[model samples]
Target: MAASSLFAALDKDGDGKVSASELRGCMAAALGEEEAAAIVAAADADGDGLLDRDEFLRLAREADQEADEDGRWRCLRVAFAMYADATAVEGEGAGQHITPASLQRMLSRLGSQEPGLDECRAMICRFDLDGDGVLSFDEFRVMMHDGLM
Candidate 1:
């Protein structure tokens, strides 16, 4: 979900592939013109224009590698939904509540590993924007769309 959300945001054109302008636009929308350009330069692996979906997804996956399975799932689902909603609409938008089914699935995905749960909870708290004890669609969208930490 987080991966999808982040990926969709990176794929600014909604054409399913990231372009230099789209990546640049998302960065600008998330950060500002100055910072966005810096980020694009950093993330633009081949510098051929923009980050392809695979490259962006790879970086996002790497960032989530340390998160708990539950937290990671929650993050991913919310991110996916938010990306859908953001791209579904246009311009800036507000947040929305995540579905109960999504929550249940997220929780169920949490493995029996206690260490994983502890680390995931910590990661969720650090990244959760709504602070409703879980990540919200809006929060994930903002994080992805704006690329703001």
Candidate 2:
């Protein structure tokens, strides 16, 4: 969903503003409590401990731009670490990239139940910039930042 829609959804109280508590609940899965608080502090222009439409949209746009720049690499590093823990081989250097099989395994572990092999391959194909049938760190970064995966 677009950031605007997400912001509206998060404004459960219908006050046309999002409080830190609301943001925490909506983003807790991807961001830590401290991280959310920091974001709120940085974006709350009026120091109201809340984000109105303009503030939220500005923050979202800035975040999107940052992700397009260096933030994607940070996200890729975290994803790579998680994937490596789940699919690392003893001597195959599997941690260097995300193979189709490894991606499937990671998805399964992430509660996908039983994602098909073809589905995993298609996902890789969508983001495999080098056409190597796998996702390199750069490819993964692009996929994440572009919201293609």
Candidate 3:
């Protein structure tokens, strides 16, 4: 991936510059606290307590090199299982089409206590390619390749 694109991914807010909190939040959201901390510490070569855009890009490149194929596949399977379960529930709309709003509602009722819209949007965007505002199986597969589960 291009360094700019990777930086955009980490930025999340589309801001012109990335702050310490933004980087920290992106890392935490993607991999949780411990892993995020480790990444920051390992990649912060200047020891300035924050990662500049170049440092973030370098770490992302290293991560791409160390890609865990098996783990990615397992994550894909788990995501598919969840999608299957969502579709199988009675009274849900027909077909494989799944909208962000509909999914947010469904997931909310399915024991996920997180009701935040950003969280729901983030989850849906992770899998919703084509900018169709919905997820099809193919889109889910692309997202699976990106390791979202």
Candidate 4:
């Protein structure tokens, strides 16, 4: 997953920690209110009802690993779902891949200085292992997990 972007979404108050409410709001659609609460409860190592970056990362990585072992792509689905939510456009095809324009917008939203289209294209080229000129979910997962972008 795009860790920083996910964290930014969860840290709704921008205080660098994810409170239970923030996590619940961010994860509710995928995990439901109760499941999200349970996740926070299990992951909050200090019983603070909040997840610091380290704690959140550990929880996410553990979840990812478990899903991988189970042959499920939960993390990738969540990452792509966030991307779609952030970049959806009217009349667009069902977005199964990340286009350069959308990626540029996503990066800018995540606080990167506005990246030029060329820069976004270059990033796609760098990670488009299939040579499709766009980033598939698998490519995105590799980029997120390996820091390839």
Candidate 5:
């Protein structure tokens, strides 16, 4: 979610700042009073015991950085789904093995400047664990996390 939207949710009264009460209420299960106070203290640069928009955005950015691994997994899953779904056959569903032809087809459909079949084959080869000349979901996921998507 956008920082502004999240800030709005945490700022309950639309006061343009999040107090300990607001923070605790919105994230009660995630932290205790001491933890919440510590976070507010750390981010409340002005020492007013609250998080303003800038402070909140910075906190959100930091939190996102902390969740980087989870975020990468989410992106990998979504991209893999798109690639797998692109070549789904009638009534066959998505997530079938991805061959170079399927990868090239997906790239072409998404307006690649030039969907190189050979390049796709090489990519699949690099990650294809079973060596069946295609990529299973696990291979595709590993390749994606390796930033080759």
Candidate 6:
């Protein structure tokens, strides 16, 4: 239940193995007994019909990764919007993506390895596909795919 809404009161034996009754108590409100049983069946992995800690942890990690992937895109969208707006104010490009100056400012705000304007310019040159000296959303996406964002 590391990443689940399992209650502490449910694992009565504290043996780190979840019985059907324990799962029913742990997840009934959120998943209902039937659904909880089904999930236990799917994630049990050993065909023992009991949810062991390792299987439960693996399931939790997968769910956590899924949540993180969704949250990453949402965060990227918001960050891009903010940077794009800042680029707009500077009359740089079309404001559809971050300009070098805007990217520099953002990095400075983040307070980590703040690059100089020259470095920022070089970064933009590396990522700008159309050679307009500015990044559009698609270009920004490519840059992020390269782990620059």
lDDT of every model, 2 decimals: 0.56, 0.83, 0.67, 0.79, 0.84, 0.75
- What are the clashing pairs of model 1? 1-76, 1-77, 2-76, 30-146
- TM-score rank, highest first? 6, 5, 2, 4, 3, 1
In the range 74-111, model 4's lDDT, one tens digit per residue, is 75677665554234464654577788888877888889
Worst 10 residues of 1 by lDDT: 83-92
Estimate candidate 5's alpha-carbon lDDT, on a 0 to 1 scale. Answer: 0.84
Q: TM-score of every model?
A: 0.34, 0.47, 0.36, 0.46, 0.48, 0.54
Stronger candidate by lDDT (1 vs 4): 4
Off by over 4 Å in 6: 1-9, 13-16, 85-139
* Model 3 pairs in collision: none
lDDT tens digits, residues 1-149, model 3?
Answer: 68787688777677544556676676555676566666678888888766677787788778776677667667766665455435535666434555555566667768888467677667777666677666776777876566664
Number of the top lDDT candidate: 5
Cα lDDT tens digits, model 5, 21-137, are 889989999988888899999999899999999998999998989799788778777777666644667676456678787788788888987558899888789999999888878
Candidate 4 vs. true structure, TM-score? 0.46
TM-score of 6: 0.54
Which stretches of model 5 miss by more than 4 angstroms? 1-66, 85-93, 113-119
Candidate 3 stretches with Cα past 4 Å from truth are 12-20, 27-29, 68-149
Looking at model 4, which ten-residue stretch has the lowest summed lDDT?
A: 81-90
Q: State the lDDT of candidate 1 residue by residue for 78-128, as single tens digits.
A: 556642323223443323433333334444555433334455456446547
Residues 104-146 of candidate 2 have per-residue lDDT tens digits of 8888888977778898889889988888887777787787778
Off by over 4 Å in 4: 1-72, 84-93
* Top candidate (TM-score): 6
State the number of backbone clashes in model 6.
0
**Which 10 successive residues of model 3 have the least lDDT summed?**
80-89
- For residue 52, model 1's alpha carbon misses the true position, in angstroms, by 0.5
